[model samples]
Target: MKAAAFDYAVPKSIAEATALLGSNGAATAAIAGGQSLLPMLNLRVALPDLVVDLGRLEELKEIAATRTNIRVGALTTHAAIEDGKLPEAFGGLMQKVASKISYRAVRNHGTIGGSVALADPAADWPGCLLALGAQ
Candidate 1:
């Protein structure tokens, strides 16, 4: 399983990364930690012509608490949340889910957005997110 040839670039912001993706068309992909994307690429499940790294996007890495609800950034790592670094409302829940994630290594690399995007029914957070109305 070999991945297709592709161009790689780390964008400083989401706007720049989105621009790269738009320019690269449907074959483009945004890679965060790459722990998941690399395996998909190797298995030939994905063959992007452009890989826009979102790891450097500070805005997407933030986890903040607002009046409406707690905000888990798209690129926020499971480990970060698991380490009790998130808001008080989500702190215990994050730890519970983080402990049961695929694995500690994968959890460290996985993200809230990645899990949500995959929409895997068996994923732990889906049920909780749904029950708690975590939009």
Candidate 2:
């Protein structure tokens, strides 16, 4: 797991992260939880010169219900979504999906954003999310 020297920042707001991305153009990237990206970095598949960690962005940790849908923050982890503390609107789908995720340990840390961002044709969540019309 080798990585090159790079600049790292824990941006408290989306504006700061946006500024970092804009300044560096494609050389910068956003990382939440760093589970997948860390492995990619170790394998040398990505080489972002700057990583804007959004771990401290409390505004992005929301899981709220709208009139017709559940609005999950892009950074919300699977565990949070499956916490079973959500309003009745979600219909236990989150919990079902959460339990069937890769593994309990991984489900705890894996974010929904990571699943969709993977863009993998064979990912487990993709089927369920698509079946639920969550694209």
- Model number with the top TM-score: 1
TM-scores of the models, in the order given: 0.88, 0.84
lDDT of 1 by residue, 2-50 (tens): 8989899998777788889899687888888676688999998988888
Candidate 2, which segments miss by more than 4 Å at Cα? Answer: 88-90
Clashes of 1: 0
**Least accurate 10 contiguous residues by lDDT in model 1:** 85-94
Tell me the whole-model lDDT of each prediction, alpha carbons only.
Answer: 0.81, 0.75
Candidate 1 positional error at 23, Å? 2.3
lDDT of 2 by residue, 50-85 (tens): 988877888777878878887677778877767774
**Cα lDDT, model 1, residue 74:** 86
* Residue 77 miss distance in model 2 (angstroms): 0.6
